[model samples]
Every structure is written in C-alpha cells, then in structure tokens.
Target: MTGTSPKHDVFHAIADPTRRRLLHLLVDREMPVTVISSHFPMSRTAVSKHLRILSDAGLVKERKVGRETRYRLEPEPLLELKRWLAFYDRFWDNRLSVLKHLVEADDANEPETAVKPIKPQAMDPLSLD
Candidate 1:
C-alpha cells in the first residue's frame, strides 16, 4: 500500500494489552520475530499475530534483514491517539474549574462556625445500666 490509509486504526490495534506491549518492545530498536517472541509468554505465532495488527495500524515497520524480518516502532500514528486524549484533558479542566467556582461561592455564604465538631463518647459493652 503506497499512499493508502492503514487497514487498522491506532486505537483498535493498541486496544489489546499484548499489542501495546509489543509496541513498547519495539520502541527502542528493531529485532527479529524470534527475539521479540522470547519476551512474551505466548507462542511465536501468537506474537507474530500481534505484530501483524500493529503493522496494519502503521505503528510498526518491518524490514527484511538477510533471512529474517526485523520490526521497529513507528510512533507517528500515536500522534492521533495523543490528540484524541488531549480533548478530554481540556474538557475535564473546564468542568473542574466550574466545580471549584461553585464550591467557593457556597463556602463564602456559610458562617465560620457553621461546622460543629462531634465529641467521642465511650461506652462499656457489658454494662447493664
């Protein structure tokens, strides 16, 4: 696929814990499937399947090194995920600001001694009186 979009979206590919771990493993350097598979408890085939999904999402790139294929992380696709999460950050910030304003307004109307402290009472468990 020269200029076509990826078959899998970054969110879908990263939704699985296994796939996320695969991305982390390939982040620093490229390694053959054998080396990558050794890091996980699953079979080499299983690890290959996870790698395939990541590749489809454009999160990782594979290269032919002699007779073996090596994979490395391509982090450009993760920008989409980061952008999506940033929107929620701004949303929560605005919501928290409104909540803080409402709480301060209510506190200002209350008297300083409005809150009364409760005294602890000791009781005897076996007392009949």
Candidate 2:
C-alpha cells in the first residue's frame, strides 16, 4: 500500500557524517554548544543546525545550563543499529558453515588428486526446478 517508514527519527539523522561526528563529540560527556562548534571550522549557526537535526533524530539531547546549551549523545539508536547488524552476521555465518561442510564432505569421499577445482553452478531460473 505505502512505502515503509522508520519507527522513529533516529535512522536518517545519523546518516550524515557531520551529524555522526557531532554525536561522537557528545558521547563522552555533555558539552556546551560553543565548545562543540569550536571543534569545526563551520559557523556557529551551522553547528546549531546540525544539532537540531541530531535532536530530531533522538541521537542527542539538548538542554540549557543557565546561559549555554549543552548536548549529550543518547546511544539507544546505536543499539538498534547493532541489533540490525547481528542478523546479517548470523546469515553470513550459516552460509559459510554450509560451504565448509560441503567441502569437508567432498574431501572425505574423493581422492585428493581426483577432486578438481569446484565451480559454483550458476542457477538459470528457466532451467532450475
């Protein structure tokens, strides 16, 4: 019916390298906006704009301390990224295990000299079952 939408604001926000860097600066501890902006050559306004994007993504929290605003990274979305990565990791593990088992099986049944280089069969959809 409709295009898939992300559950929250986190994914697209961290997609940019600048925003990721901003998050890295805040990961260690809360830092004021000026301190964060000083790390880059961009204008203070640019840093503020990046912070707004990060705030909308939920990857960072912004709070005012008297006269200055402080930013800190919120790592829950990073955990979600790790979980998504793990599924692909398991998929690769299973495929590699199957290939290893097949190679072992071939080695057991055939003489070392008799076994030639194994070529993977390209499956043609029209000819495949």
Best prediction by TM-score: 1
Root-mean-square deviation (CA) per prediction: 4.8, 9.2
- Tens digits of per-residue lDDT, candidate 2, 1-129, equal 224433346767878898889988887899998999999989999999988888766678888899999999988867877888888998899999999999999878886675479899889888855
Each prediction's whole-model lDDT (CA): 0.94, 0.84
For candidate 2, report its TM-score: 0.65
**Runs off by more than 4 Å, candidate 2:** 1-8, 95-129
The CA lDDT at 17 in model 2 is 90
TM, every model = 0.74, 0.65
Which candidate ranks first by lDDT, i.e. highest? 1
